[model samples]
Target chain A: MHTLREIEERARAAADKPAPYGSDLDLAAYIDEAPERSYVDSLEQLEELGEEELARAGVVKSGRQRSGSFVQIDGSVVHRKALEKGLEILSTREALEKYDWLWGYYWKAVAVDSDKYTAAVEMGPYEGYFMRALPGSRTIYPLQACLYIREPRFVQRVHNIIIAEEGSELHIITGCASEHRIQAGLHLGVSEFYVKKGARITFTMVHNWAEGMDVRPRSGIVVEEGGLFMSNYVVMEPVRSLQLYPTARLVGEGATARFHAILVAQPGSEMDVGSRVILSAPRCSAEIVSRAITKGGYIAARGHIRGEVGGVRAHLECRGLILDERGVIHAVPELEGRAEDVDMSHEAAVGKIAQEEVEYLMARGLSEEEAVSTIVRGFLNVKIEGLPPLLEREMRRMMELSEEKAL
Target chain B: MDTMRLGLGGGDLEEAREDKETVLRVEDLHVEVEGRRILHGVNLEIKCGETHVLFGPNGSGKTTLLMAVMGFPRYRVTRGRIFLGEEDITGLPPHERARRGIGIMFQRPPTVRGVSLAQIVALCSRDGVDVEGLAADLNLGDFLSRDVNHGFSGGEIKRSELLQLLAQDPRVVLLDEPESGVDMENLQLVGRAIRKLLQKDLRRRRTRCGLIITHTGYILDYVEADVGHVLCDGAIVCSGNPREQLEGIRRYGFEECARCTR
Candidate 1:
């Protein structure tokens, strides 16, 4: 394992390097300092953040149905709690001060020198959430976390760590958003997940950014023997530019991973998002699915699945819909099989809605506009497997709410 | 065969028939699809509490007439007008016509990838209808959550169409081919569903009407038709009892029907 000093040195060396995908943004354009926010004893004490704003980002104001809750505003941690037993929720800074062994997991799954965004998160003063489930413990309700940007022209950097121990199951819902009035801002987030042997984890994220905000998030995951990892991501509101490509590696035999994403780009917005999974052990499997819709902007939806050993299976699917004449959607799905007995495949489709489909709905008493909206709603609804019922309902509600604003 | 000419002229025919009783009237209708004329000067009428059957050979424009009456944009009504109870609906779009008590079932509907059958059924219903009960009656309760027309069997498709029509409860139901691809088992279900939709079980006070296109005339076993028209070259050449016309066509075939003056 590399020392913390060595990691810092590596991050500093790669601070000027650019990522391979997406347009480059100047880091100097955003300020690092903002007005510090005082910590709140409970979420109800948050007077500045409106209930409607929190609800739009899939955060319950009362925290009635969540096992735990975490709230961070700009660079400060406002609220953090763990309501259930066998669960730990704390700020990364606090967790590091409490446990010295956490340094082993830091920057282990994700390279600190991968790109400038990850490097910036390391080199800058940032605060994020750290959640963990004890061995053999299962959460009844998912934990909820909100990372909000409230300052204009400020860059909010965060790094999160999540872990599920052996025979344990954990579910998390993370909502990322900015203030309604803020037009120009930046968000850089780095997340690392570890699923131990015979463990399972499901992470669902909803993004409700402003029209002129730019976001860059880097995430990585590792699954051990007989473990499972599933991720569901949704972004429906407008953002000036957003780019993320999270990867998961199944390193133990019989491990599995699944990733599903729903993305919508409004006018003047640009998004480049993708997911990749690598199967390195025998009998491991992975699946990636994405649905992208462009109203009047540009979107690049991509997926990649690699099988490196025999007896492994993987599949990737990407579907895109262009709703406006000026809108553009590009789907890129890749599959690679390095072993003889490995099975991998990919399918991608990008086009406009069929005229016949529109007419068929019209014959059923729907106006042209109503039919189109219904179809769009159905297109955005992707049924994820093995998701908790509450999380599924919350995701649906968020999608419907955003559909009203975006469509 | 002698030509049985019922003088179907403009304005005079409307005057001759009871205007209140006529549910649908097509006056000298001509239709074009993709810039090619398919129907030329076709005249037909269906009254309240009556069902009409149309028979024609392959590519004889049997489906075109139903599509034109349903107000599909691609059917392209080039000449003449269509009236639903004295109100002209030639320029209205399909959804407007559907809202105005006109519903049609396609021969081969496209499969909608994510729209479920239950959703379409609910959309078609204007009032609170028992969707699950109706689907159960059609033996399609298990298919309610599935995508519309996705990988459905021929019989299942026919039953699904009937289910939608039942929910719609339109005043004039246009069925392109009700018995085209159904099997022995599902044919009875489809035929009975059509009977229920057209209100054929009632011997008196029946207000619903239907216009069905069939090649085999097998639907006659369940629902009785008041009139059967043989469309030859896009024009109705014969009009009489449905069973008699079916027997005549069976004996002489559509070639003889086209050659006959009637």
Candidate 2:
């Protein structure tokens, strides 16, 4: 129950966290001889998992070190990283946005305790988490995770593991947040998922961070025959800059996936998010909705859907609003089908509040500001309607907070 | 119709403290928009309860005159005095002017897609207003839950604006082309809404003022205008009793005299 070595190990592990190295490591294989699930209740268990996760993650790095690929990310050009099946994640220390040289202090960190996936009463740090899937192993009880950054940091990375048995169904929710006015930080993480035939996977992420934070989170989905993957990303913050592309590949016939993203950028923030689906199977379908609001800054969204198979049906939509004159919004929707029998389509629009419309509200006794806010909130009615109960409340709270800032 | 009154005699409003009305006074008013001149040395005055009609062709600065009074950022008064009673409103923002009892109805109501007509009316009602009765008067009872003018027909926009004016209880209700695109039934409903507004008391009882802007006299047959001014090229080209200018503009049109007066 108590071990000084475990505490020291966990401290050393947390101290030396680096960028995630493995996109392919099976945490399930290490389940044997590994610390018992009960040990997680003890620091010793944590020490072992953290150590094992770090070591296995090194194996992943060796795999990448074999490939002719190197990690290079910076301003303007967004990037992402993920673990296909492992416990190792990249973690970087906080660094200034202009300080690119300090990225080496980061370590890729992943939750190593897969046994706590269904533990109703979670202990220290494992309350919630991001997860990925293995090549052959699948999970039924989706794991929970969270990511939080308080100070300027380098390319911090995280990896997740989610495996569904041949016909298992799972739902996982990941949350990320930081207090307002906290020192600016960076979060660059990724999730790689594998869904077996007849399995269903739904991964939801809600992100709210303080200003000065720039995030580029990338995710990849590999769905087998009769599998399903639905992804929803809801961001409620005035993030300085964000570029994310959560992607899915329909590799087996009758597999389907859907991606939905909603982000509201207040007076001086920028947000960019999209979903890309590639149909590799003969009869797979994908649908995506990308919505952004630029009240004072900018948001650029680019979405693409490629129906490479003859019987695939895919739809992509990108819609956004610019609430102020100085605010900017850009949307790009693309669809490419190699087969004549496939169906694909996309649409986008951006605009400001109309004068006559404002007058109409003014005559009704609402002040110009109130009128504009009402109109804007109304415009998001459709997108908000599509959100789940928990996320919808969070979105509404974020809107109210932004309005308070305006006041 | 023996139905015009002036100023609400009260202690205070949530925004305006004193409700007594001495009407508007404009002297040597000069207004500009987007770095270009519009109103050129215009002077005018209105009695507390006078009904004024502004007549001019499109883009003759008729709308600009009203817009200038509303304090739109686009229009700047280079030299002028605009007073509500003795209070100078020239430097005030649009909302500030509104808080002081000046309300305007646009020719085209602003479209706010998810804001319900009823929700806004309740917001305007300010202090425990009877929204149900107000909706009934403007014939907007059926569309209570519908967003303000999002999918409203032409008639509905006009009448709904009237309902808001009544609920807001502004001392001066400036109607911009109130007769445009109004159907026969809505014309009656809109007129009746104005009539009720002109008579609605903020508390207990008080007379309300009405300023109707138009290029046609159809609104005159419904709401009586005490005086009328011909606004051309940003300045009032001519001024006279509503009975005189309404008929004069109709007979001679604003083209002949509106140019000469400026």
Candidate 3:
């Protein structure tokens, strides 16, 4: 494995090239000014940017402000409580020495030199969370982390890692957003996850940004034998543009992964979100589902499932609802099976709300707007079993709040 | 046994009202759907304590009249006036009409995805309406959690429609072909439900008014309709006692009624 210094040098070397992934998004206009420095001194001062407002953006009441939490604002770590039992929360740089084998070993799984954004995060000066759950431990409460943007024309880049040891379970909830004020910014996020044998991890991420902001997030996960990984992503606020394609690879027998997302694109926003799953071992299974709504913007939802070994199963579904004539929604689904005994399938649908449905609700005493809003709320309801009750209730409440905002 | 004893409500209609006050009136109504005229120069009036039955063959514009009265947007009233108890609701939207106590039971309602039958019933039901109890009453207990009218059998769909009508508790009920496409078992259940909905068991005074459209005339056996009108080719050709007119049509066919009108 390469040393930390050598890994940093490789990241610096890769910063010269641009990533060749999705559609080209021009970042020159937003990054013209020098990035703003963190000026927040206390948690109270950070709250002035409005913690309640930030919480509402992600449908959270208030973040876990209690003990054992990590809060960062504008590339600065504001407050990080002491470690809890069986849990370790460290900064990426500090983790370099703590886990010697993790330095240059994981970067090989993710392409750092492919683009400028990844390279920016890859180089030395990034701030993110490095969390690990000790073996044979179970934690029901989620370890909360937050990242907030307060200045205009600023570029924020981050890299995060999370690992669950064998026979352990953990949940991590992350909230990322910009200040409510009208400010343009760019955010590049890279996350990697590892689930050891017989371990489980649930990750929930919520993003809220201004219409002038651009976001590019790349994530990857690998699950060992008898392990499980579940991910939920949501973005309800308006952003200039966003592009993310996260993947999960089941590398051991009896491993499973499920991915779900909800995206709402308002006026002047463009979003491309997708999930890919690779079943590489026998008796492994994967599922990906997404629900997207576009009011007057552009949204493209994609899902792909690939089965490389026999006796593997996968399912993918993508559904989109367009509210305005100017709005556009595209559904792209692909299923590939290489082995004869593998089972893979996918489904995609894109359409406007039925007029008859609106009328039917209206005839039952609901106004036209209420009828439409109710249907949109129902359309966004995608059921994912095994969620913790509290988290599920919070998600539902946020969906209701989003319904009001949608109308 | 009282046939009009709705599971959701129990009131003697005989003591509720007295006299023939006009509850709904349509004058020279002209309606077009998809640029094709379906109802032309049609007039109808139902009193506060009366139930009117409309009899017609296929494509006779009976359903169009009911839709026009309920203020459906697609059924454009090119020239007409609709009055609900002296209120000119000609330009009202469907919800406003519903708020004014006008409700309709569609022959075939479109299935709504993700909205459960129980959820919708709860949305429109009054405070006293027992949604689960009503579901049991309609034999729809197993369907309460399912999507509205989705994957339901013909009988189940009709029963579901009646279940919603029962929840709305409207003053003026408009039923379109309630007896059609229903099997024997469901036909009895649907007929009884419609009788209760129209408040037909309260002896001399039928307090709640209704306008029922039926092609089979099977619903006539369960509900006591005071007046019957025969419609043919977009016009009401004759009017008389419902049973006698039904008998006349059944024995002599609609041509004889047309000849009598001429």
Candidate 4:
């Protein structure tokens, strides 16, 4: 583990390095602008935003009152809540002293440079959540977190960490959103997760942004032997541009990692999203499934799975639907096998809805618009079994609302 | 006097004598699909509470006539107008025609991905007809949640079509080859469903109207056909008693009917 001084120095040194891929966006212009203070008039604004965006992200605010849940606003921790025992929820600055052993995973970034965003965040990093589930702890209820933006032309950079110790299980639901009418803003987030031996962690992230916003999220996960890591990511709202490619690596025998993502690119938006998984140990397995819809926008849906050891199995599936003539959907699926006994497979397809299928629905008393909405809803409905009932219901409701807006 | 006419050897005069009101009327209908004319100057009419069966050989424009009447965008009508119960629907879209009480069971409906059969059926129902109950009646209870016509067997596909028809309950039902690919077991169920859909109940006289297109004449065994018209080369060449016409065509074939009409 590197010292805090070394971490700061590395971030400054690596700040000028260009992104390895997906750098079609303009980060210099955003870096030149000064960050603004969040202009939230009242809690009602945050509550309204919660209903408009966070609800789709599966975080239902209890009336206008902030419940006993962790909530952050404009890169600052506003409300903090967690279980009393076997769990610790704190900000990165607060956690620096109490959990010295955690610096190895939290302070030392992997696979992503601190300078990925021009060192704007690493030089004077903003506050983000740190959740740790002690060994043998198990909870049915998921920890809820929200990161909200209320000001225009502001930059909210967050670095979050989740560590599930040996034999523990934890699920976290995080929602990120901003005011729908905000002028322009940027959100750069980095998240790292550690699932120890025999531990399990399921992370669900929902993102809803305004049309002038640009988002870049970098995340990675490491699963120890006999551990499991599952992730569900959904983005339904429109934004100027979004680029994310989260990776999960199974480094121990019999570990498993699964990723399911659903994205919608509205008019004038560009999205380059994907999930990558690497099975590095024998008997390890991984599955990546993604469904993308482009309505008058552009989307590059990407997926990659690698089986690097014998007796490993991995598969990737990516499907896209283009609903408008002006829309463009691209699928990029890659698979690599390094051992003779490894099994890897991938499938990808992109197309528009068929005319006959639309006519068939029209024959059944549905108007053309109604028929299209029904078909798009069904196309976006990729079943993820074993999801908690409440989360599943809210997720489905969000998809329905998204489909209604698309039509 | 009947043999003096050009097409169908004289069904117009007989149609004028009927007391029932005409439910559907096609006059000088010429339809083209994909720049190729498939129907030419076809004239046909069916009254309320009447069932008309059209018989012809393969590629004889039987399916094209039904599709044209349904107002499919691809099946362009170059001439003539279609009337349903005093209203002209020649230029209306398929869904508009459906709203005005026109329903069709296609010979081979294409499979729809992700849309369930029950979902489409629910859309067609205005009276809140028990979808699951109707599926049970047509032996499609197990396929209620499956994608429409996806991976369905021949019999199951037929049954699914009938299930949709039952839910729709339209005033004018157009069936294209109801028994062409169905087996005996499913045929009975499909026929029963069609009979019920047309209100052919023993307790009450049949009131719903239908225009059926068949090549095998096997459906005649299950439903009462008031008339049989042999359509050859996109024109009705002969019309007579349903059973008598079937027997003659069975022995002499459509070639004889075309020759006799000429």
Candidate 5:
């Protein structure tokens, strides 16, 4: 019953959310000064601050890189090749910050009172931003970016890029959240993981947006030899609709990929999630795990882990826990093994909290609801132990953002 | 004279007013589960400050009787009434019964993950119980910050369950096989924890009453048992000295007691 700004003024503090640490990046104060990442017309006359400067300058190199060939089940080989082209997105800070939410899939807000648009936050270019990892120095520390769009606008678009040198390891975490109820928004973001041989990249994202928030994040990872890629995504929002699929192509020998996710949809939210892995090299391994929870809510999880090249083994596991009767969950884990010698398997489970389990705690004097809350918290906690203290704090901080309860 | 009708018409019987000290009294309790009959008219009573043992074979309605007493929904009492200090509680919900100062220690206990033991102990307390002091009593001073029961060993579970029951401050405590899967040392820990629950005076309050449902008599040796009943075939077929029944059954079996049935 309030305007977007007024509502944002009254909502619970982000501190109640789960992340273990707060970032120094002040969204309200970041100046639009020079564009974060934009192209220069003269490439030959630019001076840079080492690799960081090159990355910030949007100059990266990729060519004639042959990692190895992975033999498929049909005896065909997937030859590892260089990513032929480069992609860039440049925008002013205000233009990018206008759509703050990272996974806002849907929203609708017009001056906070002109009740005409019931738009859902859609991930696209408006919420879009660009970054070029400096050209030469291999990036070791990953960058963290976040978008928080309130109800005044439910639509958004985002584009991001990362370029790795011959040898570097980078980790990134991105998030999306809404500011107003029923804010219709959109998110369409592209992440180009241009990895040179022997570089490692890990991208982890956690979303706890409202039920109306919808998200679709697309990623492309081209891995060279001895490189690695990992994805950790934990989403606990029912109303915020979502569709995220990260693609990885292992181009180098010993290239590896792993994706782990936990989805919890409480009453009144809907989510559709998916992931895919393409192995084109021998000795390449990929693992995908999706944990989904639906309580009076809905979750559809689909994943594909394929072994296209010979000597490549991939594993996929998806587990879902539905707390109440009305809650629904659907999970499909697919394994496409092209090589007969490839080792691959997929498993998925969906279930509710056991009655005896509830009675067990009740006999000890705890209420049924309290028991379920504890169980749910513990089940997802297995992933919390692995997150960085700061990211963990941030993840926890976003958990309280669910309009249902105070943190 | 006792079996014959002896009171004025429409007048309540005076017997209910007499044994005011009897904290728990069950008469002719017939319980069923899933349309399958279980307990057949079982009668048992425990006076204040007394530890009563309900012994039985598996599926002997031991756990069923405990669940019914604890007011679990699945177990139905077809006939008879469970009286707690003259109050007829044959049709009360589990939480209602819990509020009325009744608690239990589950046989197959479920862990309370993510919720701190301290927090759980406070929420489950009928008398606003303190978690740390109770944990210390049961030698759980170090695990208070951890989640309830999750990842705990058998002994930790038993001890922690007792810690929770101690916090409840109930007049009658129902234990559903407290010694299952526990080792000898853990069994000792269980016995000690129960002893503390039975004897402690929290902030100067009345001691708790106990109803222990167990197959083994190890708990009996550690905690004093004022009355013992063997439940089998849906009823109490035998009742006598706790030690005598335990030792006698170990050597002579139920067939020996069947010969002397009512």
Candidate 6:
């Protein structure tokens, strides 16, 4: 394992390197410093933060249905608590300072010097959530985390690590948002997830940002034997520019991974989002599904699945809908098979909603506008397999709410 | 059999039928699809409580007539007007026509991905109808959660269409080949569903009207009709007793029927 000095040295060397995808932004334009926020013992003390805004980001202010709650505003960790036993939630900085072994997992799944974003998160002053589920432990409700930017023209850098120990189940709902009045801001986040043998992790994220906000998130996951990792992401509001591509690697036998994303880009917004999975073990499988809709904006929806061993199976589906004449959608799906017996496939489609589909609904007594909205709602609805019923319902409700606001 | 009435004008017919309230009337209706003229001066009228069967060969504009009446943009009504009661509805859109009480069952409907059958059924019902109970009666209770018409068998599609119509409860129903893809076992179920939708059991108090286009005339065995018209080459060539028209077409074929009318 590398020491902290070596990781910082590597990040500094690649601080100027640019990413391969998405438009590059000048990191110097955003302010890295902000006024410190005092820590809150309980989430109820956060009532000063608009409950409506917090709820829009999928955060329950009361924490009634959350197993744990973590809230970080700007560069400070304001609130972090574990309501249930056998679960741990802490600020990443504190966790690193408390546990000496965290260095082994940090920058292990994700390379430190891979791009400028990763390097910036490592070289800059950042605070994120660290969550872990003890071995054989399972929570009835998912843990909640929120990364909020309350300052204007500020850059919020975060690095998160999540682990599900052997025979344990962990579900997380992470929401990233900015203050309503703050228009110009930037968010750069790096997340690493580890699923041990016989473990499962379901991560659902919702993004509600201002019209002038720019976000770039980099995430990676590693799954062991018989483990499963499922992720669902949604972004319905407007952003100036947002880009992310999270990848998962299945390294043990019979492991599985699935990713589902729903994106809506309103006017003046540009989003580039994709998911990639590499299956390297026998009997492993992966699926990546994405649905993107643009209303006078631009979106690039992409998916990649690679099967590296015999008896492995993977599929990728990317579909997009263009709602306005000024809107544009690009779908890119890729499938690769390295072994002779590996099975990998992909399907991609991008266009406007079929007029025949609209007319079909109209025949059932829906007006033209109502029919179009219903079809759009269905297009964005994806039923994720293996998701807990409560999380599924919550995700549906969130999607419906955002859909109403966006459409 | 009623003899074929040739050169009948719309004004004269309206004056002659002043006693009966016409629920649906099409006059001098000419239609085209994709710039190809399909129908030529077709005229028909269905009064309240009346059921009409249309018999024709392939590509004879039977479906086009129904589509034109439904006001689908594709089936352009090049020359004529459609009426529902006293209002002329030729300019209204399909959903407007539907809201005004006209429902149609397509022979091959497009599959709407991610839209469940139950959702569509609920949308069709203006009131809060028991969608699950209605679907169960149609043997489609389990299909409520499935996408609309996606991977549905031929018979399942028919039953699903019938379920939507039942929920809609329209005043005027247009059916295109209700028995085309149904098996022998499901044919009876489909027939009963259609009969119920048209209120056939009501006898004297029936208010629903239907215009059905059939190639095999198999639906006649379940739902009796008041009038039958044979459409040949986009024009109604003959109008007569429903059973006699079926027997005549079965024995002599559509070609002979068109020839005899000429």
User: In candidate 6, which residue ranges exceed 4 Å CA deviation?
Assistant: B1-19
What stretches of model 4 exceed 4 Å from their correct place? A1-6, A24-28, A31-57, A63-68, A83-87, A107-109, A118-120, B1-17
Local distance difference test values of all predictions, in order: 0.89, 0.60, 0.79, 0.79, 0.61, 0.90
In model 4, state the lDDT of residue A367.
83
| DockQ for candidate 6 | 0.77
For model 6, how does the per-residue alpha-carbon lDDT over B1-262 read when each residue is reduced to its tens digit?
Answer: 1123532222344344456678998988999999999999998888887788999999999999999999999999889899999999999999999999999998999888889998898899968777788888999999999999999998999999999999998999999999998899999999999999899998576788999998898999999987788898999998767788889888988898899867
What would the per-residue lDDT of candidate 3 be over residues A43-147, giving only the tens digit for each residue?
Answer: 445544465765654423343422245666667666554346888877666787788866644565456765777777775356777788889877657776777
lDDT tens digits by residue: candidate 2, A135-155: 344333233344544334423
What lDDT tens digits, residue by residue, belong to model 6 across residues A1-407? Answer: 44778999999999999887788989988998888999999988885477777788888899989999999999989999999998999999999999988878998888899899999999899899999999999998999999999888898989999999999999998899898678699999999999999999999999999899999999999999999999999999999999999989999999999999999999999999999999999999999999999999899898888888899988888889999989989898888878899988888888899998888888889999999988998898787999999999989887887877889
Report i-RMS for every model: 0.9, 2.4, 0.9, 1.2, 2.5, 0.7
Classify candidate 1 by CAPRI docking class: medium
Q: Mind giving the per-residue lDDT tens digits that candidate 4 earns over B1-262?
A: 2221333333554755367777898988998989998888888878788788898888889988998888889999999889998999998988888888889998888887777898889888868788888888887888998988989988898889888988888889999999977889888888898888888774765557999988888888898787678888887877766677788789998899889877
| CAPRI-style grade of the A/B interface in model 5 | acceptable
DockQ of each: 0.72, 0.33, 0.62, 0.60, 0.26, 0.77
Candidate 4 vs candidate 6: the lDDT winner is 6
What level of docking quality does candidate 6 show? medium
* Predicted candidate 3 versus true structure: per-residue lDDT over B53-171, tens digit per residue: 89888888998888888888889999979999999999999999988888888888988877889888887786798888888989999999998988998889889988998899888
User: Between which residue pairs do clashes occur in model 1?
Assistant: none
Task: Report the Cα lDDT for residue B37, model 1.
Answer: 90
lDDT of 5 by residue, A213-297 (tens): 5555556677778877777776765455566566788888988888878787777777777778888889988888877777677
lDDT of 5 at A328: 78
Clashes of each: 0, 46, 2, 0, 89, 0
Error of 3 at A141 (Å): 2.4
